[model samples]
Target chain A: MTIEQGSYESPIDRSVFDQFAARLAGDLPRPTVVETMTALLRQEIIDGAYGPGTRLPEESLSKRFRISRHSLREAMRLLVHERLLVHETHRGVRVRTVDVHDLGEIFAARRVVECAAVERASDDGAALAVVRAAVREGQQAAEAGVWATVGTADLHFHQAITALAGSSHLDELMRRLLAELRLALHVLADPRRFHEPYLERNDEIATLLERGDRTAAASALRTCLDDAERQLTAAVAA
Target chain B: MTIEQGSYESPIDRSVFDQFAARLAGDLPRPTVVETMTALLRQEIIDGAYGPGTRLPEESLSKRFRISRHSLREAMRLLVHERLLVHETHRGVRVRTVDVHDLGEIFAARRVVECAAVERASDDGAALAVVRAAVREGQQAAEAGVWATVGTADLHFHQAITALAGSSHLDELMRRLLAELRLALHVLADPRRFHEPYLERNDEIATLLERGDRTAAASALRTCLDDAERQLTAAVAA
Candidate 1:
């Protein structure tokens, strides 16, 4: 179940959850110890370092992070709120597992959010540049045969699409949604097989945006996402 | 500025945040102490029991909730993630203040979510019934001159609009967005003057949904939301 890790293949210097927490909490002067821990665990979980349903023992995490029990508990609480982890009575915390139904709901949300974003995508050069950059990154990663990087780039691409809305709230929501999507993607048997086809579709959507055909872009993206959702749902169900 | 309090006027027996937390975390056997405290405080903040920017003293909340410092800290962290509270250095956690820009961003998100939901509203009678019931509740509350209830009903109505999409993710996202909007609405000098005009619009949108005029409903909602964003932004700026 090993997937991509490291900064070279990662899309951003900060984890998606960190960016989400920062935006969500508004501009904070500093990240607390708990926040730092939460971000690391979040990235690790999404990166498949901790597979779904793996228990994160409080004592072990406290030892690993060299943080207090209080701090680790706080970090776990934050991850629970983010839906990256779940806390069960007596059993402690475990990474959340997504099933077929969960995937359907996630894809339903992606369709609503990304479709709306592309339909109203901004004409601003900078926002469009982000969409373009993500597409290039995904393409390049695929060309290099780094499917893990390709997965990260795909998340980045969708995140950029929502970013075009210029709503911090939407960005925050999209971040969480994409993180959940990453979790769902883990069920795939072959990362490259799952992500390879979407690379060209991502490029097509980017091209449509660049040409200012937002409706067409949105339509194309919707069909593509539906197909992706069906694929993922079937994988999870199996 | 006391507005609404108590269960009769409140839209739900459980706070919106509790429902959101429960759904987001998936099914769990029981709610932790931290979860209980977070829900109560979240309701208080959204209901105007604690006004925006009001610092929630740790010692007092620890006393009031009669929970340990650790439990309180965990609860506060959850609220901060939900954007109901913000933690500042040395100053401690305070209710999040929504400024004019924040209101604009929030409204932008509402437009995206509600518009998308209504545009693809489910044909299921049960779903439409919730929308209709919320509409009636608002109308009745308005006629009874319970402006606070009217305000809550409005939140319920929009929530039901998103609920039509049948996505728990959107419902959770809408809960947070609407909570932020509630904070922004606190800026209005007169609650009646602020929410009165929208009651009829809610009914109109509900009617459109009931009749399966989804496109029209979505168009109307987008314009109404735009008008609302403009009005709220002006009020906050003033």
Candidate 2:
């Protein structure tokens, strides 16, 4: 079965499909077929196309991408390296499941990175603009009742916060952290209830940064992250 | 020529050789030949065996390991993923060079991780014991004038600090950060002068932590990181 047949189906799955259509329409560069496939599969996995513990059918993926099994393995290996997929000896490759233990550790990391980013975030106009734009995107998505897109926007908002620190290394760390976070968040039973409250908090933090109130911004972000971790932990435990 | 001929020869090179001898004598488990090779190469690179920009001789390495070119390639790929080595077209794989820009970004990440780790580090007896042990190791190495071992001890000190945060992810991030740091630090003119003074400061931070003075400990760490970054950036720029 394709990823669309996975246990957790999102309304925003079409957005990922549209990205594929756009890529095929020559809107983006494809360095190699394997890389292109890897990028798309990574997005699919992060977008919750395949829920936790779903076994990926190697034959079907190879056939679906019209690539050789060797190429498919290369793509899967990349995801495996990213910890988004796991290859067990006898079980083949399956989506990695995030446990409550992992959730706690991940949030600990997030608290360290995100709070620090906000504290040191420079008042660069371009960086702050990205934060505002992400907030706007999340607001619009929430208005349209698209929680998955809202989740993506929230990640972008955090990414923008890290960018304000002016360190690509931290930005990359935030990116990977959020991807794992997306996996952990897939366990939440009500996506709308979980994501809606964070939208306003994101805006509040962004506004605090815009006003040069970094102390308040950092404090707000720490609270936001703590609340999120508790909610995610409770959901994942269930 | 082997890695011993690399431009930056260290007295610690013999230490790496000793590890190889011990491995051969079955003092350590060889999970797989490729993994064994990868771990050895990773340690060598981080230990400044092959200095920054030193081209790794694929042919000699394959011969020395008695492994096929494919297995060597797999091992090299792992280091490449860790950002310890870069593979350029037509140039083969060589040790990655950390420039001024990269050094600045790396220290920024370090500040976020290490400082935050100190701020919230638990006063667990075992964790604090690791901190004191690493501090003692650095002091002993410094007294013996083994600056290279001192450097290793210094990294261990920081690694122990992050461990006190009780998150394996941050610990892993610190490992990668410190490896890249070793590459950047290879530019320093005097290893003794660079690592010597930090031994006392390491003791200071550990003492502060043991006293349950996390705020002071974090403050001291932030200052230490700032000074080191300034020194490293100046050396790298030169």
Candidate 3:
């Protein structure tokens, strides 16, 4: 069932794999083994075990995860639907290869959805507190020099901003968008370069929103997204 | 495999099914028969062949659709993923029963995503024309006294407004939202009561957008969504 020889690369870095293991180790007892496999495999993708465009043969993955082929197929099916992986009819699945064009469109969507969220949000002290907490977390992660964790915290800031609109559906939508955004981030030559500059901008947004200057916060978010889009586009294009 | 006896119902009214049949009949030569079956079954849900909260027993449905159990499972799996159906552990599947609390959250989300879309949309004559076209279609459907179709057209109108943001991700998100909305619509005893007043409101918003009054259009959309939410909430409360 191992369809290819070169695509599947087991993670050799114990330190990095340990982080993923610790984070996902506490997922309440999964209903099915497929659920567990999906979580682990997705974390592997995020941890960069398998690089972009690598084939994820179901036969190999089921063996690696110690699950049945049926369970593996279910996990792959969900990932494919999430656009994290692409399923080819005759060739099987691979990590999605997001081009610069897709990244550009995704950022444009982020601008539309996220900006609207901040702009329309009411001046709730409690909501602003949550967003500020996410920004502070991002800064602390950056101070600790954990760039990968900082990106996670940065995504949390954006998610918190979306939450201000008081829509669970939009929150779900932003979660999906951010996952896709991460895949796009994985394409960069240096993922750290992609997230480092945005920490300060996130702080600015949190501060603006706290001051009830939502219009200014939204404008800042738009520019921040534009700058990130330009940076990613240049990286991918290069 | 015949696990249930009374859960399957073959839709007798081909006229209603025909509308769904035609709309979905040209799904571009499905790669697998499961894809075709999924589309048709989804349409049946939309057409109310299987009412909300009714058990969709796998064994019975496989027989009704004249497909293998494997293919039926595949289709049901996709629908469950879309939130159109709920799969209970050991109880098989049923059309999702959306609660009033969920309806409030979903409508609130619609206001955030859709109002932001209209408010920020470019005053493009061509884009506005497409929106106008959807409004015209809704009016025509209303004039012909087809409130169900009018509801469909109104969904299209809101979709068009989201499209004005020109972000495909938002469009995909809205598509998901609208599907959930249709599920909510299914809970209504009189669908006409939900859609009739919105037709005029749709026209007004379209006119506002055409005149470059994006603020007015957005305000109108917010009110429209609020009114619909109130209507649905009252209906569900009753």
Candidate 4:
């Protein structure tokens, strides 16, 4: 009998391994299974479901998610690429530990890339709307004391700004870096310590872009990044 | 038979896969059978064993690598996460296509990261040697008319320069971006079309660095990037 290569079109069913892959035919919709799985694990990581430097068992996750071990492994590999998890050969996968240097580098790269995107947004009015909405959402989240929501909204604000640059390539690179940055923020001493000031700084940077002052917007963004870096560094040290 | 919750590390016989990974793991090596397999595939992509947009069959690769289908699949998952390969479920994995737009974004991100590293390298004399050696190697490869070798050496040059910035985090990001860039370059027509001018530009930038002209060095680097972008765009379109 010829071995079937598996189905090419379908949303990866949560049931069987081959079916799950068949589902991932083309571009998946937002909030797809992989994304849902990512969000769940992200919350768990932030909530300390798994401690830093702790191995995450594939078998256990499979049972917990009610999915096959194969699907769970695929999810883990994605996280491993994101720097949220570290996969060791015989040792198994574990939550990645973020140190002071890791934080510094992440923020440094973020500042350069994000600030450039903000500058680009000033030239494209359409992109500014997305950034403005993200800032508004961030403010609302901060007022409600939803630190996790605020952190995520803050990323959306910047991501919207980058999208204004009209480069899918830049967006892809920025998205990966932002994912790692968000994961690092999750490990800070108190979530509010990082998210609270971000609301104000994001507003200032957004306002600069809305007013079409690209230089001022970029400078404000740089300062905002500096503040975030300082806070993250202090939190990691503490 | 009951499966254990955890398995101990067991000695496995060396396979052809071990040879490449063994070399890669030399400096703080993190070897696992899966990672070894991933590295092998990466080398193949870099070596142009698989052309762009060509579907990579799991069964074919598994048989060729002399590894189990499961192990090969796992490796493919890792590369997919790394953006080295794109997976479309039943359609199988294929080398990712890097268009002119992708190249532009990659270079833009590289400039931001690499220039910052060069600025940092100004204060660290010890790291200058790495850049110097890479420059020499790049020049020699160009002289020998080995465009692919020149491209690979050029990456090492920039990687060394970025490492001098003293951030493992940036180094990691650059590593990922560079791998994608290498694959993208493979599809561009005539390596010599890009390589010849690239060598001259690299020399100019290196000379500026040697003279302690940070401003001039950064400027020269940007110009070189612009030229490279134009060549890549022309090649892709042609």
Best candidate, DockQ-wise?
1
lDDT of 1: 0.82
lDDT of 4 by residue, A1-238 (tens): 1212221122433454334344443365433455456556665565555556777777666665566677567677878877788877666788877778878877766765676566545366667888889999988888798888888898898788667666665577678667767656655667787678778888887887777888898888888878878887887676
True contacts kept of 2: 0.65
Give the TM-score of each candidate: 0.87, 0.85, 0.88, 0.81
Q: Which candidate is the best by lDDT?
A: 1
Instruction: Evaluate all candidate structures by whole-model CA lDDT and list the values in order.
Output: 0.82, 0.80, 0.78, 0.72
Q: Is the docking of candidate 1 incorrect, acceptable, medium or high quality?
A: medium
RMSD of each: 6.7, 5.4, 4.9, 9.7
Q: Given the true complex, what DockQ would model 2 score?
A: 0.49
> Candidate 2 lDDT, tens digit per residue, B15-96?
5444664676585443455566777888778877676788776766666656666667667766887899997644678889
Better of 1 and 4 by TM-score: 1
Give the top-scoring candidate (TM-score): 3
**Ten residues in a row with the worst lDDT in model 4 chain B?**
B1-10
DockQ of candidate model 1: 0.73
**Whole-structure CA lDDT of model 3:** 0.78
Which stretches of candidate 1 lie above 4 Å from their native place?
Answer: A1-31, B1-31
Model 4 score (lDDT): 0.72
Least lDDT summed over 10 consecutive residues: which range in candidate 2 chain A? A1-10
